[model samples]
Target: MDVNGFQVLPSQVESVRLIFKRHPDIAVEFRAKNQHLRNACMDFLLSLIETMCQSLEDLSNEDLVEADIALTYLKDAGFKVDWLEKKLDIVKDKKEKEQSSLARLQEMEDSLLKLKQHCSDLDALVEKEHEELSDTRTPMSFDDVV
Candidate 1:
């Protein structure tokens, strides 16, 4: 079957399913590891966003002291901004790696489809040869041929 322009071989699907079934515990272990990384990145970004929002609110408040404090808060916000920018760069790199993996998987799927087509062609050729061979058999009377 085709999935998003990639042909999914029956053998590949079976192998993936077998791997998942045989390594359920390991699967969750890896997933937990990834979730931890993702959560940390998200938390960092959220904290940065919250800080920016609070700074904006403070700057807009009627109190002159709060507006003055917002200036100092803006300076403190710079570190979080830089950290978030670096984290975003890491995310971009991860996305690029994922795209490369998908492309490789698609190439392998295309190769498998070509292999299946060749096998099908070979099977048809063999069937045709068998039919032709059967057609060439000479008819014989039992006594006359003997």
Candidate 2:
């Protein structure tokens, strides 16, 4: 128990009790309302997480020193910091995805704009050719149509 930094009641009896050896004052006890072991176990785990979060909440939000203190406390208690690492990894992945999506969207927009400019240029060329052909032709009153 000392090495693991936590201990559970040796056997299942009647009620649930989660006790911290270091902080004996911070403990929770409750009975199973529905007599379902799974629910009882889940509730007990949730309470533990809540207790941990509350302890973290007591740290100052503006100070890195407080954060270091919390980290030291967790490390001393043999808690794994893998959750923090996983969170940073998730944030990095999401940012990368967002940046790539933005780049693709910008590329598509540029291609569309270039296509539009090319179409406009082609339309002007067709108009200019029509005007030149009209000017070069000899004009006669109704004779051209006949």
Candidate 3:
């Protein structure tokens, strides 16, 4: 879904979900923007990587060097190259509950159909019994009919 012009592909979302499932300990926060400040930092770093200190650029040499070391440490600690979690507004538990509710509705419908059929059968039987009773009644003499 496109939220604020950020198109979230279903496959990408599923991949992120699978990654989270695999690494349950990892916690993710969905924010309107990148809270870690990596996006801007990465852009600076990418420019530096391509230019190799030839361009003075935005970041100073010392800051760039420090950032490189920090990134190395982060990578060593297994915290690098992770996906950002966005607020997709999906709830698995809610979906499951809806499915169960639909199943219950289907069962109720089946029961109602059965009840209607049974009532129909009872009415037919009553009608037949009344007809038989009428047939079994014997005619009486005109004086005795009263």
**TM-score against native, each model:** 0.40, 0.39, 0.37
lDDT of 2 by residue, 41-121 (tens): 434443434433443224233333443444444434334444533433454455566668979999999999999999999
Better of 1 and 3 by TM-score: 1
Residue runs of model 2 more than 4 Å from their true location after superposition: 1-81, 136-138, 141-146
TM-score of 1: 0.40
lDDT of 1 at 64: 30
lDDT of each: 0.47, 0.47, 0.47
Q: Is candidate 2 or candidate 3 better by lDDT?
A: 2
- RMSD in angstroms, all models? 23.2, 12.5, 19.3
RMSD (CA, angstroms), candidate 1: 23.2
lDDT of 3 by residue, 7-112 (tens): 3455444544554466543322222255334333333323333333333333344644554564454344344323221101122233445668979999999999
**Candidate 3 accuracy as lDDT:** 0.47
Report the C-alpha displacement of residue 60, candidate 1, in angstroms.
Answer: 34
Judged by whole-model lDDT over C-alpha atoms, candidate 2 comes out at 0.47
Best by TM-score: 1
